[model samples]
Target: MSYISGARKVRVMARYDVIVVGAGIIGAAVSYYSAKKGLKVALVDKKYPASGASGACNGGLSYFGKSGKLLQDAYDSLILYRELAKELDYPIEICQDELFVQLATTEEEIAELEKNVEECKRFGLDAEMVSKSTLHSLIPGLSNKPIGGAIAQGGLHGFVNPFTVIYGYLDKVKKLEGTIIPNWEVVGILTSGRKVKGVVNKKEEALYAPVVVISSGFETAYLLQSLNLTLNIMPNRGVVLVTEKAPWKLKKKLMGANFGSTGQNVSLCIEQTLEGNLLIGSSQEIGVLIREPNIDLIARIANNALSFYPSLGKVNIIRAFTGVRPHREEGPFLGEIKEYEGLFVASGHGGMGITLAPWTGRTVALMIAS
Candidate 1:
């Protein structure tokens, strides 16, 4: 059937220029750039856009916490996000987040904090030792345990509604003559020899495309596996809580060493959104997990949030939810996977999808454009 958005029809008999499977942040990113390049692209999603981890994530564009190459990639991706926010004119809020990697109230942790502060300064980032008095000036309710830690100035973060980011891209894609099929769950992938042809949708419609990029999160592995491709993707669930509109005790974002409950060494940070709600999150649990929010975990998050701001105790929690991140055994599998010629991957971001989505979209677009 021919669609008016593009010059051509989606042929069941012939292949399209590109087909992007899974319309999460990464997929939408690819589609946004692909359509902008004037490619006949189709963005197919089984559910709706931002229905997965993309929607459930905190929009933290961070350059703290990360040390070596990861830090560098993060900085590069931030640049891409900055460009996209401007070009797209999306409500991308850039905030200077203050990262306080709390010490464990022990002598060893104090030493390590000093060492980390030194290492961070080498990157032209600031990480100074703060006294309890100094810390209270920034965050009055900060835990009285550890003494001091690092502080990177101009730590830029772009906070937007994840759903907005996806839909904004989708809107631009449509304007650029790209096709989008919501609720079009991909059931089967058609391939001949080593080249991909197309996929069978949930409605039993056979759509043809020469290039396919898998941008789905944990569910991507199953979709690829059906096509004889195995993706080493693991589902790690992170939960978050939001409080009713409260006065801003937090001047900037707050990050600690571990979740208050799990103590999993993951970050538990809180940032007040453009809306008055304060987003408190997140506990990182390994392996494919439960959707039901653990009340105990929520309690821990509340405790941790209060540790950063005692006044937060008065704020009522409006909701609790979880978002899954895709983690692979061989680290993040961006670029092309060698197993398939026309197949590409953009998943395995593991809690950093929001931070990585903009550049990922641009990079994947460049790959297909080349």
Candidate 2:
């Protein structure tokens, strides 16, 4: 019902009920859920889906790595994951064999573990205090340098490939007759007085839609500022290393605030792919150069992995990469943009985008519905 700007005769395309910007996990989820609710949705992105932080992230759903606020969100997100997997019937690698191991290298660290265990239990999570012997029994190759650590049970960790989530959701969106346009960079947001009417793409093509959702991760701030909207999102870069296929006997995934014996602030997590390659990652450097993989940093990650599980030392490092997490100024950025009517945002998930995507999708859909 709206006219396309910069056209010869002002051609008008059918007006869309909702328009989602950025094809990352957040945007895809919004489009998928909105379309499922029978809304005419259009998902547009400058690049292809999963080409941003979603593509570069490690597939860990660890509750231990999450802060207090994110821990609550993670718990809710796990329930949402179960429902999503059932509804989508996709091959989601969700498993319940996740264990958090605290290598207590010092007396203070042991007390910290106790406190974390108590905190977990208070949150209704099943946690257990374990000794050094118990830790070794569970993970035979674990470093025996600690007096004791805490273990949290029933922790659900999954490995949902970002690309799989993107394509799977796209299928659902298409099935609902939703449109997906790639290579359509949003040049400007069109407003009717004080309300949003549509957005102009890079090619000067104006696409009209009543509701516009911005899910551009860290790039959202720049896009919103163009429309005189304020948003604070910072990019935190994480380095991940993949090791060659090896004899895999590590059953439970391990998480520790201390990656190595040096007591550094890093998370050492291990996940073996179906193809036998082991994925290990840690380290968060914000506002760092993200053009190429940092070999020195990735090597530190590998060493940390090996220090915890010596069995991985012999494995060759095949590849290394970095992913940028879109962290909001503080907490999550969801709901409507107060500055512009009809403009909504769902970015700044930090590093838990995959875990929260489904829930955010449903939440945004409800907002658009209302």
Candidate 3:
């Protein structure tokens, strides 16, 4: 047990068994899972849930190309989504449609796609290879490009609504007697020696908790600095375009093999949202946290979308938006901070925030509880 810090004993606002700083998908999951474990959880965020990268990201769960723990965690999260579809109060809208297709326009990409197929088979996942002719027949709105790519079937390889995932998870958390504190940005962590007491909100309110979890994306660095700790995390900005309701049909959620290479790569990812609007994007710019959309990147996304689907040339672009992912070279970090007891972290998910949220949350919640 801990109290308000300093000589002046300020009245503490509240206390919890676990305090999660960030209302994004990861935090939502942690809160929900922790509450399920019968722990009193308080989820705090600067704004609404999924306000950052989680809201802006597409709901694709592509765990096939990942390595080691990243791949295993992602795949496990995919399986969990099926159960969540029935459990969450909100509608997650996990796709019951065809597979997720990655179109390869060049030989280099085709070779990579082949390797991806092999990876899928090695893991007991289903994958299919379609020739250019078959690909055109399979998906109608193509522009005679893309020789053929990999199609991931089964599991939760399709797509889900990003916003809904956050709401659904947090809704369940609330129903489980957990707290949801929005607009309460955690500015400082109140610690006693090497042990965490709780955290200080932006308004300087002390909220006590034995276990404190930090998953506040780019803001995590500032929180870590309060304890003289450091982590290799950076913000990667991605831009996406939303087009008017298309006249034609897009059978599958398609991504170009060219995109998603690393920190600063552009994607030829095109998918139709459940709202029937065509979503196309994106360009990744790292080392910058600007959430504003880039004009040059916007233009490139439009041109690339047109190159693949000529039918979209006349389609009106309704709007554009950007989300910044907290990227780390070694993938996402999820575990207790050994230096400080009762402290844990879940951040640096890169662009795979949506794909890895379930695993990150459940695993971190267990770490704190166990």
Which sections of candidate 1 miss by over 4 Å?
1-15, 92-129, 259-267
Q: Estimate each model's TM-score.
A: 0.87, 0.89, 0.94
Local distance difference test, each candidate: 0.72, 0.75, 0.82
Alpha-carbon lDDT of model 3: 0.82
- Please tell me which model should have the higher lDDT, number 2 or number 3: 3
For this target, which candidate reaches the highest TM-score against the unseen true structure? 3
Please give the distance, in angstroms, between residue 319's alpha carbon in candidate 1 and its true position after superposition: 1.2
Estimate, for each residue in 99-131, the C-alpha lDDT of model 1 and write its tens digit: 534433456656666666666677766567666
Q: Please, what are the lDDT tens digits per residue for candidate 2 over residues 94-149?
A: 55455545566668877777776677677887666788888889877777665677
Total clashes for model 2: 0
* TM-score, predicted candidate 1 vs. hidden true structure: 0.87
What tens digits encode model 3's per-residue C-alpha lDDT throughout 1-370?
A: 3345843244589989999999988889888889999999999999988898888877677776675666678789888887887877577777745468888988999998888777777777777777888778777768878877778767567677878888888889888999999988887887787788888865567888989999998677778887788788888888889999877667577788877787436778888876678889887877778778878889988998788878788679999988888888788888888888888999989878888888788898888888
**Clashing residue pairs in candidate 3 (N, C-alpha, C atoms within 3 angstroms):** none
